[model samples]
Target: MVVDLQARLRDALAGSDVDELVELGCDLADAGRQEQALACFQRAVDLGQDWIWFNVANTLRELDRPTEAVTAYQRAIAAGQSDAWLNLAHVLDSLGDLAGAMEAYRAAGQAGGQPEGHVQLAHLLHQQGEPQRAQAALAPALQRGYLPAVALAARWRWENTRESADPVLEQQLRAGAGVDGSARADLAELLIATGRREQAREQLQLGAKLGQRECWLPLGNLLAGDDLSAEPGQEQEVDGAEVDKAGAEEAYRAGIAAGDEWCHHNLALLLLQRGDVRAAEEHLLAGAAAGDELAQLAWQDLHQQD
Candidate 1:
């Protein structure tokens, strides 16, 4: 049955007069038959189906072959599929080929495509330690309601130390936290670093209530500090211990049960500090396998002890 279907698909592809081959290629790619899909897409491109190149590029990217995706996107651009240039920039950025990403972003801009190109260029510049240049690049979009402008402005205010009490920054932090995990974590870290531990705790508490795993590590650290100092007094105590060790243990177990990587890493550290090496190793190993860098480093330290 599968062989008959394959033969039918081949005949249909062979008889394609327009872009039917591209559609067939896309279907094959979506169904996880990547090698066959690539062949079909290559044939479509050879038949002068200009639009097929973007699909081919996207498929290559999804298959974890960014270099080939870059080439495919470039071919699409050369064939006048200018709208694909922004996506090409994004693929290059994901591959850590920032120079190529910048070039593609520039081409996307020239093509009058997404305004996000400017924001992406600015972000890349900021990451490369050219904050002033990044801010300059973001200037045009700043007045146009681009969300990245808030982040860029916050970064500028932070770097310049205009004032730690800047209301603009506070507003930006709140707005940023509403958008993504990384932004919320950044705001929390910044608040803690600036001695606004209470505020950071509040933000983290809200994040925890909302079921955000990203808040657990910093929040746990904060709580651990408070625990060591005996905050909330005897009223919050559990298991006949100060700082509610029982509650902390429960939270840690809940996080572990939910498979949170950061929770596992932080909980491992906490347990290690409490002299529970066996449990610590288990959680740390799980976290390390999940790509938690801190957990991996901690595991290395543990091995050195043996």
Candidate 2:
């Protein structure tokens, strides 16, 4: 009886429609026959299973075929699959088709897929250098709790007004204490920008120990005093110059071994401070060649001094 039932099930699947084929392909994909599963999904789409087109598109994307995935996602959209629009936008962005990605994101926003879509659109707009449009795009997300309003507000205050006048920014900065790597890094940067160098250093030290690569550059710059590019009012002089110099040198050395460009630049500055112009030039050249703008500017400044 069991054998007969199994055989009947196999026969039924063998004569199945596009939807069944998609289900089989999904099973195959879950079982790790990714290539064969993709082929099966493609066959389902070719058989006009419009409802499964989005799933096929997502599978194609997982298989690293962004261009084909975009086409499949477009087909799904044409078949009235609104939910696939965000995935389509992400695939376009991954393919470096930023314009198309933005258009898809806008469409997704219009379809009311996710409130976060508006925030993503705003971020993309900001990346494209349209801050005003970005701000406008964020309005919906801001109202709907999809965006980090407090953080965004703090950032805006820091960017546009005096830090001293912005109590909210200070509160936000304090609220970020003991957070994860990214939050700690952000807080460190804000601290440095708001003239809390010691606090920034402490935060960065904690971040570095916690494996945050982003903190290394700012910490290195602070150590070297070469290009303390902290925002206005953010500079802090060390109490004991010699001890600070030694600590900075050690940090820079470790940072250089970790392949940090800012560390290389800081090391160069340290070398220059120690009157080793030739060695400083070598590090400066290396950092500049690696496309560090600060290093390039520093190298040019040093060349002018020469």
Q: Pick the candidate with the highest TM-score.
A: 1
lDDT per prediction? 0.71, 0.69
Question: Candidate 1: TM-score?
Answer: 0.70
Per-residue lDDT of candidate 1, residues 37-120 (tens digit): 777777777777877888889888878898999889988888888889899999988888879998777666557455577777
Q: Give all candidate RMSDs, comma-separated.
A: 5.4, 6.8
Off by over 4 Å in 2: 1-34, 46-48, 62-64, 79-81, 94-96, 147-153, 173-186, 192-198, 205-212, 223-264, 271-290, 300-306
With a 3 Å backbone cut-off (N, CA, C), the pairs that clash in candidate 2 are none
Q: For model 2, how many clashes?
A: 0
Worst lDDT 10-window in candidate 1: 231-240
Residue 291 local lDDT, model 2:
84
Instruction: Tell me each candidate's TM-score.
Output: 0.70, 0.66
